[model samples]
Target: MTRFGFRYRARRRVLAAGVLAAAVLAAAGCGGASGSASSSDGTVVLRVPDPGNSGVLARGKKDGSLAKALSAVNTKVAWTGSTGPFAPAAQQINAGQLDFSQGSITSAIAALGQKPGFKLFAQIAPDKAGEGILVRKDSPISTVRDLIGRKVAVNKGGTAEYLLLKALEKEGVKPDQVKRVYLNPAETAPVFNSGQVDAWAVWAAYSVPEISKGKARFLVNGDQVGSQNYSIWAVRTRFAEEHPKVVQAFYEYLRERGLQQIKDPAAFINVFTEAGPQAFNGAARELTISNLRQGAAAAPIGAAQLADFDGVARFFADLKVTPAKVDVKPHVLSLAGSGA
Candidate 1:
């Protein structure tokens, strides 16, 4: 389909989906509620992922602005003490144990393939340099073709794996020519640095520190590989339907803070550094700020986001990573004024 045709189709399907969501919400009310708890006075306790380790969320929570803002909408924040590897977070959202979290498009696609428990309500454009294939500075393998016959570490069904597939395809290399070691982000660094894996396909959280420390360099990034792995926020379908106002408020909070983060990247980066053990100090910290400066802020979902979602869904289906291509329009919703 032409670009305009695809976008128009997306808008129509999304509108239909929005109506369906409202109906689901009404049905949920009759089913005795499926999301976070509400008190006798009717204040919603929004159960969300812990923000202590994340840059934007952590900063917002620490300064009390996030809480104060939510109170105005008759919602209370409940920190669920969880961070991400978003697949598990997706599962939590499905089970109603969590309400919201941010993850890559690949994770959302994979989760939706299993169950339609959430809707992608917001998106951040791909951070091209933030995710890629990482190799030790002295590794003999320097190009995508060099990856043939080599072992690479990647999080199965995640951005790293997606990027690897794209990178290999771009270089005209077949997937089976390389041995892919499926490992979570935490396990990748140890195996890659110890020479157990020839290279690690990873995102910024893991790749940046190594790159800044001079231990590794990018063999290829999302930009070179033609990646569509945008960063996305998922809210439980029930939660969003039951509390649309709260969801919109949260999105607004993120959008505003994200804009501020872009303007003064260091302020947010400093909060990120102080929040956890994985300190991106000195050059690493500076590199992160630079990435943030170039990064796209979060915004309500739109046609561009829908197009990206469909692209990822089709890519995964073709690779057999997913059983079938997902019709992303039904599984996503655009809030008022969010259309592209």
Candidate 2:
């Protein structure tokens, strides 16, 4: 053959080899590095969010415990962390892009208002100190009543907004009394620090750093204002129905690990904070450890938890935070206990 002809034949052979390899992988049911798929070997790949790099699932992924536990039930995890607001996470779950994740009950209720995309499998008790409104330490706003007429940043339709609403109600302040600046967490952080917003209704992720640095203080914590919020784990609705065992196994593992972490926050600090990109340092790290010690832990979904979820849904609906009313009972799966 001529040199050009020989080169053409070599290229064809290489292309054929690549095609064969791809077919082999497809036949094995490999769903790439991050997604939900089942292999011929009876292993199920489940896609889940990383939970801001400080949640149970993130820590579970850092160590081998999560995988090892799931292996017994023939399930694998794919940590496909989400970016941006809760709406995106809800959209992903609705579109079947994610298999499992954890978020506040407020977000879950908002998600259910649109469609039956996911189901609550387990719950974490109220982290009273994990969320609240924050103001500069030297700010004049010393009481919830003082928030009237001041600008406060909150992620609309989220825990922060919920907290702010409840706080205002507690203080007899009308919804329109305070200026609600609808800003996301990232936006609220810089604005709050720069004194553009009088106060920011936020979660521990943003508040802890500022508090630890002595630049901010909590105007009102969830506990102080009787927050009924709960942290919940959700599985894709169809996925949960299709793979109940997998969901059960993962929930049990999370519950076990979460309990352990609650008992000894230091033991899992490395995995929760040091292993992820959003790791905390210095005063923030110390403050995180302290908070975790007193924070909530994973628990099996039950009647009481469902009742609280219903209350949250009702509250959001009544306040027009959610589009319409949602009944959370139908959207939850009581795997380990009675949740009716």
Candidate 3:
């Protein structure tokens, strides 16, 4: 919060930039948003390529929601395409690999701690609906406290991990008291459903399918614990500075488009997965649609949201999830000059 601290963080980013430049050069043409490109027609092209699992932003092209918004400001787009989560995509952005990405606050804090030189552009969907820890519907682990000494599956270093930490704290339990089985999505359902892990702390995506089947029941959810995954949009800092107008267009687009998606997630899932129906199967997509309606709330980037960032940062620090405290305030941008 002090001037010196700000300078120190800035210096760290400068150093990280040098390292990122090397990574960019080494991994050229690998795929996804390619370093702020332009089209041959003398039009400026902004690359996003990936919209992560949700594809909420990427789907904007279908309705011309993003394209029209950007074109209104004289910008064209080049799709580098989407692959994985935000951390890697964010790395590509910092390394000049991509120009933008969206992710949960926990991952963004980790990215910030790494000094990726990306700025938080907007808060997209802050929802208290899906964060949950589940056990078999007939299981005896009926409450958060009941998980004491029992194994819970979580994707370590991701949102689910943070949920477990906060859930335990709210229930007056220490983290180590429960067994944590760390697994990615591919391995989670089998391990969890077979009773290899007594409970699974997860939100949306992989968790939704199982819960929708009526095989599992929630022991606790974000609404119950007063926590959430504040999903956000982030831009590579250099790109935003060089093309402020372009960034502003995306800001306006995300705000307007995100509201539309949250209001009708079923429609969003339809558009987002039309090309790749396998992206989310019938069960998962339906569950997501239900949760999005019940959970998603849209808000402008502001003090209250920033405070949530601080609280999550402290949670990361306490769990030693992040190496040290990351001052997230400096990187958040205001939409003043952006076309409202």
Candidate 4:
């Protein structure tokens, strides 16, 4: 089918899917109201999910930064693997499988609309360098427009998809022209390496490893498109509302740790790279440092940030990634002392 024909058909199907999803979510109540309570042993464990690659928690845990902060509050921190798009992790958070989760702002927004129980409370890296559509070093796909009728891997509903869509928009490629293969960060590399996918739209840890190996080259990067990328930490609303102290202390810890990294980029990069994601070695080191240097220091998520999130939500809605416009403010956790 022609690109125009495919887009026309996909649009109709997407609209139907969006409506059905909305109706089902409405009936299902968008989850929440079931987050796990404090354990019987009187221990408060906060389960946090990461994108399985950023190594943010790893650095903190290794350096005892997290231990010091959580210990002071008598809270136990558990690191759980939450690779890929992170929509699953968000759903896990809604189902009470997780106390909190963090990832691409796109997934958080999508989850907010799909599942209502969670709240976005903190902003993490807005780093955009090294994030882009990567193609085999010798591949014929030389530019964004070269991807038409090609296969590109992206984690649907996550930052990968958002960047891919935005890139296509900028390049004037119809959405249906490129086939988007959905895969998690862990899964994407193998598939991309084996020539299973023509290209990959990914960021930071995911894209850096491959680029360092000289296995692929950027057809275009996130910065080339514009630096709108951001990751956020979110907790279950009930958790925030009920255990304000824990939430406040948690974000405070994150903000402090973030500042520490910014204050000493060289030391931070050395620690993060050597502590053995091991993928960040070789040529990847320079890229990693560049991204860290460009990364946003963790900070409170507030009005201007909320407005940016809301704008992204509208972008998703127009593209039918979400059922309709979502006013993101309702789901933002605004605790009194939380610095959220």
Candidate 5:
């Protein structure tokens, strides 16, 4: 099969099976409680996965800002921890297991590509600064080109997969030329540290802790591979269609509170400390904040973001990451000027 053809087929098979599994779960009543709120009822249960290592979510949880802001609209959020990523969350939401959850633009794209039933609610902060490829501290690999023929651990069908594909292409390394291991973050890190893999393309929230322990060295940041993208808040399209006002209010709270956090780096970092120990030290935190500010200054959901999404979709298409050439624009939700 051609490179794209092979990857696309693989993705389709896996995602198709995943959708079937979700369908069974839905029929079996194995999902979360249905989160339905009327304008008259005063609670909005915002179901989020356990913010395990998500400093942004953890920080918001710590200061009570995330809850307080939502409560302003007479909505209270309830977080639900699950092992599933965006696709399964979409399934759960469809199965009436969730109201809303945190997801990246790529996650939403992949999930929607599989089922097309979720609606992007709002563009959260562009966490572009968070994803990267890291090598062990003592590893001889110094550059992306050096990784050729080496074993690399990546979460296949994830943001890291796309990031690594772009990095490898930029370095003129063919996909099959390297040894790629498919692993989730939990599995990838321990094995990466134990020398089972030469490197890892991991999300920043996970990568930071490894770097802090001197377990790895960053080879390339995701921002260098693509335009600054977002971690979007999305819900089932059915839910959104029935409750436009609730959806609007939720978006408004996230945009307003997120912007406030972005404006004050020091305070943001302080709040993040509650998430965990320092992975990005003060210097790193400052750099991250600067990048977030740049993303915030751009239109919340601008043409630039759409362009980036297109570029990413094309990259995945060329790499044969999905079964079909997908259009990412329609899935994105732009809550412009509703930062109340």
Candidate 6:
């Protein structure tokens, strides 16, 4: 062939090879993309009750802390806040409508015993001596001893119930010795204010409102019960298995941000107010900072924390809340050593 003809033929062959290679890479890319999309099909949804009470989670979402952290792992988070108490949130998790929920250790333990569909995933916040037993401002009941034979309202299957039981035990009182009235904080608050119930076992956030209204006085705090407890985050076992990475990322996000908040009280208080309504702004912010400091000083999740859980489980078992004692090791997920 002539020189020009030979050059043209060489160019045609090179162009053809390039097109073939492009086709192969395109096919491989398509297959890999399809596999990845299929592998990550669903978004993880975390249900938290009352944005007011969920400081780290709520502030993380509002300030993009959760979103930024989860984005690094290519996971999506859908945070839904509950309007009522934790029972409704627990029900949602039981019904499989939620992947996980934030609740008190007592509530999660009770749910695990009653509903076998869920499992405790992690301990979120250690009890900070915050919750209390409250009585009407001018009532004759000055001490827990005065509550004997009195109608004391407590939300059964809730943190309040556990606190009340422990408090009574510490005071050498039997559970059945007092008239226990089961009422949620929302329902019991009004009645307690109207002198309907002699006392109310409630968290500090709820108790603050009643106290501010001159309707209630703090009788005892959680620290007086002789047990150090914590709040927990739990998920359905199936859901956790399916999304282990997502679960790890969620836990890490919370821990990092939670610890950061624990370090800076003023910053946390500011972010907290921005997270939700200012319903309990002043008191809530101050109390949360105080509680965070306490949790920070406590032992980080390790064998000691596990032992603490064992004590908690025994407490519940003794109260007949669970059929028998449970080994908390199998249920607790420790992100600290997981290297996630």
lDDT of 2 by residue, 114-139 (tens): 86678887777777875789999999
Segments of candidate 1 deviating more than 4 angstroms: 1-33, 272-276
Question: Highest TM-score: which candidate?
Answer: 1
The models' CA-based lDDT, in order, is 0.73, 0.70, 0.65, 0.65, 0.59, 0.58
Q: How do the residues 211-287 of candidate 6 rate in per-residue lDDT, one tens digit apiece?
A: 65566777887778764456666665666666677777777666676666567644544434344444345654455
RMSD of 3: 8.0
| TM-scores of all candidate predictions against the true structure | 0.88, 0.85, 0.82, 0.81, 0.76, 0.76
Candidate 1 vs candidate 6: which has greater TM-score?
Answer: 1
- Judged by lDDT, which candidate is best? 1
lDDT tens string, model 1, 1-340? Answer: 0000000001011112233334333322222226566655788877765544336777777788888889999987766543556787776667666677778888778888886688888888887877889999999987999999999998888788899999998899988999999986765677889999998888777777789889999999878999888888888898888888888898888888888877877666555445335445678778877787777777877777788789889988998888899787888867767764
Q: Which ten residues in a row have the lowest lDDT in candidate 5?
A: 1-10
What TM value does model 6 have?
0.76
How many residue pairs clash in all the candidates, one count each? 0, 0, 1, 0, 3, 0
Clashes of 5: 3
RMSD of each: 8.7, 12.5, 8.0, 9.3, 7.8, 18.2
Candidate 2 stretches greater than 4 Å from native = 1-36, 51-53, 82-85, 272-277, 337-340
| Poorest lDDT segment (10 consecutive residues) of candidate 4 | 1-10
* Residue 11 displacement (Å), model 6: 76
Instruction: Give model 1's TM-score versus the native structure.
Output: 0.88
Q: Could you tell me which 10 consecutive residues in candidate 6 have the lowest summed lDDT?
A: 1-10
**lDDT by residue for model 3 over 95-191, one digit each (tens)?**
6666766667777888888867788877744445666778888899877899899999987676778878888999899989998887764457778
RMSD of 1: 8.7
